[model samples]
Structure formats: C-alpha cells, structure tokens
Target: MKQEDTIDFHIKRTWQSIAKMYNEEASKYDATMATGYVLLNIDKEEGTPSTSLGPKMGMEATSLSRILKNMEERGLIERRKNPIDGRSVLVHLTDLGLEKRADAKQAVVRFNEAIFSAVPEQKLEIFFEVISKVNELITNRKIYLKEV
Candidate 1:
C-alpha cells in the first residue's frame, strides 16, 4: 500500500502540520508549541505538582525539565517546595505565566472553533471514535498481531 494511504502516515502528517501551525503562532509570543502545551496543562489556581506534569503531558523527564528550566529563567513559573511532600516540588505560574496561559488557551479555543465549524458534526464524531480506537489498539499492543 502507498504510504499516504496508511492510517499512521495520515495521523503523523496531520499532527506535524498542526504542530507547525501552533509553533508559528506561538513564535509571536516568544514561546514554542511545547512550552504552550506545558503552560496549558498547568493548573492556574492551585499549581501542579512537578512530578505530575510530565505524566499528564506525556512528556519525557529530560524534555520537560529543559522546558521548565527555560520557563523558570523567563519568570513564567516558580518552583516551590511541595508543602504536602517534602521531597517533591510544586510548579506555580507567575503573573506572566498566567497571561501566557490565557493566550495559549485562546489559541487552542480558536483552533478548535475553526475546525469544528468547518467539519460536520457527524464526521467529527466518527473521526474521534476512530482516533480513540487507534489509541486503544496501540495501548493494548494489538497492532501487528497474527490472526488465529
């Protein structure tokens, strides 16, 4: 089969396109798509636990650490000792972070609105279902199995 006809190829290509679009938009604010994603995941009010951030975002420890370090240097986030757990840390957004978070939120909302507006509701539902099944199959390691 042609590579363009494969499900994984389409999925990967679409994701790459979306990431590029998001990164271009984020550049205006001196942020990358990765940083914007992290900003959105962080809780605005109570702050998020440092260890939880990586898992929540499906990000690697090394990459998350570098992004967090850059954000801290830019005064976007502050790491404070976790009161509940002495060994862990809590990541809190500063005033600047809050502002950037709002910007990121708006960008996400706009993107969703544009897509949802263009796509039919029924088509969108089917798309979501297909994506969910793909995720489930991958999670369960069901792909590439030989038939009985």
Candidate 2:
C-alpha cells in the first residue's frame, strides 16, 4: 500500500502538521508545543499536582520535570508542597504563566475554529469517531502482528 493510504501514516502526518503549527504559534511567546500543552493542563486557581500533570499530558516523568524546571527558571511556574500530601508537590502558574496560558488557550481556540469552519459537522463527527476507535484499538493492543 502507498504510504499516503496507510492509516498510521495519515495519523502521524496529521499530528506532525498540528505540532508544527502549534510550535510556530508557541515560538511567538517563547514556548514550545510541549510547554504550552503543560501550561494548558495546569489548573488556573487550584494548581495541578506534579504527579498528575505528567499523566494528564501523556508526558514522561523526566520530560515533565525538565519542562517544569525550565518554567520555574523563567518565572512561569512555582512549585509548593501539596497540603494533603507532604511527599507530593503542586504546580501553580505564576502571573506571567497565566498570561502565557491565555495566549496558548487562544492559539488552541483559533486552531479548532479554523478546522471546524473548514469541515462539515457530519464529517467532523465521523472523524472523531474514527479517532476514538483508533485509540481504543491501540489501548487494547488489537493491532499487534500475528505470527506467520
């Protein structure tokens, strides 16, 4: 089969395109796609737990820690002990982080709006259904190769 006709190829290419677009927008605010994603996952008022952030963002612990460290150095976030758990920490956005978060939110909104405007409602629904099925299949390991 042609690469363009493969489901994985299309999924990967679409994601790469979306990541590039987000990275381009994030560069304006001195952030990367990952950083902006992390910023968005954080709670504006209560803050997010350090452990929860990685899982919620689908990021590795090490990658999340490095991003958090960079954000702290840039005055975008602050870490404090979780009130209920002495062994855990909570990540709260600084005022500057809030500003960046707003920007990131806007970028996301605009991107979604652009896509929504271009795609018909029915097609969009089907697209989401397909994506959900794909995710379910992957989660269940249904795509594994069979022995010859």
Candidate 3:
C-alpha cells in the first residue's frame, strides 16, 4: 500500500484503540475529564447557566443535562434558579465538588503520563502536532456548521 494509505489505516486503528480504551474505563473517565472540565469552567464562571455549560464542555443540551444529573447525584454540583432569569437555572460547584475536582486533576495527570509514556520522547511533540492539525481540520468542517 502507498504511504498515505498506510497512514490512514493506522489512524483508523489508533482511534479504534482509543475508543475501546475509553469504553473499558468509562466510569473513571467521567470523574476525571468530565469533572475536571466542569470544575475549571465553574472556576471561571461560578454560576454559569446550563445552556452555556454545554458549549464549554462540547456537549449537547441533553448530554450535558445527563452529566449534570450524574454529578448532582454524586454531590459534585448544585443547581439553583438564576436570580436574573427566573426561568433558567445556574450550576455551581459545592465544596465537595471542588474537592473532587482537585482529585480529578491528579487523576488526569497520572492518566496522561501513562498514555504518553509509550511515545518516544523525541517524536511525542510531532505526534501531538499532527493530532492537533487533524483535529483542526475535522472541527472546521463546513458541513457541521450547516447542521447546526
């Protein structure tokens, strides 16, 4: 096969591997990346509306609501009526949520270390640059904007 075809094949396999890994560790992912994102966003905007939260987390309204629900049940977040907009609700992190967020931060550091350790140190930067370029191309798809 051509070099381009080989690259494409490996890319597909790499993504499949990533998906499988996430599926296997689904529970750990939520409390780490999911919680970390919410915590960071909350730190930036302490009482953000659920509507805005979805965009920050790259999630749809339904998905964000589900995540919020799980976090709420875990005592990681709290919702209250927005005083400025009675019809809308705002999300805030409780003390427990902040503590969990701290833990999640550490978990992410360890997780990333384990993942990146496989890459040869000299090639790691180039690998990430390629990943970034691919992500940019994917995210800039005109068809996606049309759908939204």
TM-score of each: 0.96, 0.95, 0.64
Q: Which regions in candidate 2 have their CA more than 4 angstroms from the true location?
A: 145-148
lDDT of all the models against the reference?
Answer: 0.95, 0.94, 0.73
For every model in order, what is the number of clashing pairs? 0, 0, 0
lDDT of 3 by residue, 1-148 (tens): 7765776688988868755554445455455455566666775345788888888778788877887898899898899899998999888888888777676566557668986887787698888898788778788873256543
Q: Please write out the lDDT profile of model 1 over residues 1-148, one tens digit for every residue.
A: 9998899899999999999999999999999999999999988888999899999999999999999999999999999988888798889999999999999999999999999999999999999999999999998989888889
Order the candidates by lDDT, highest first — what do you get? 1, 2, 3
Instruction: Name the Cα RMSD for model 1.
Output: 1.5
- Note the residue pairs that clash in candidate 2: none
Candidate 1 stretches with Cα past 4 Å from truth are 145-148
Residue 19 of model 3 has an lDDT of 52
Of the two candidates 1 and 3, the one with more favorable lDDT, higher being better, is: 1
Q: How large an RMSD does model 3 have?
A: 5.1
> Compared with the true structure, what per-residue lDDT tens digits does model 2 show for residues 48-143?
999999889889999999999999999999999999987989999999999999999999999999999999999999999999999999989889
What would the C-alpha RMSD of candidate 2 be, to one decimal place?
A: 1.6
